[model samples]
Structure formats: structure tokens, C-alpha cells
Target: MALVETATFECGGCGTCAPSTWIDYDRLLYPVCPEYGRATGPLA
Candidate 1:
């Protein structure tokens, strides 16, 4: 048997409206997380 995963992303271009904060991650850059509802998780 085989397995697959599905993910979705939505950008509202709310950079100006987005909150201003400092977040540290493994990567130098961070990913954009929209305010609106979205699905994100691991599937098996």
C-alpha cells in the first residue's frame, strides 16, 4: 500500500496588517501563516 499527503496555503497579502513579532526557527527565513482558516498537518 501507498500513502499520500495534501497541504494547502493561502496568502492574503496582509504583511502590513500582520502582527509584528520576532520568531526563531531552524531556517533563516520563516513561512507565512495566513489568518484565515487552512488545513495543515501530517498524513499517513
Candidate 2:
């Protein structure tokens, strides 16, 4: 059996969240928000 820690990454004030994308160069755990676009920082 396996467990997942988090389902999605959320930015503050968005009220929504999505899976994160691996940015190789910058090495950031970030999400691509539809309404607000890409997040500037990783989740805290």
C-alpha cells in the first residue's frame, strides 16, 4: 500500500490548486495555474 502526501499545489488567494511540474533548470516545484498563470515560488 502507498500513500500520497499532497494531491495538488496551491498558490495563496487562488482557492484552487493543481499538480506541480518539474522545472529542471530552475529546480522548482511549481504549478501552472490556469487563471493566474505560473507561480513565482514553490509551495511553503
Count of backbone clashes for each model? 0, 0
lDDT of every model, 2 decimals = 0.34, 0.50
What is the TM-score of candidate 2?
Answer: 0.32
TM-score, structure 1 vs. true: 0.20
- Which pairs clash inside model 2? none
In model 1, where is the ten-residue run with the lowest total lDDT? 16-25
Which pairs of residues collide in model 1?
none
Model 2: residues >4 Å from true position, as ranges?
Answer: 1-7, 22-32, 38-44
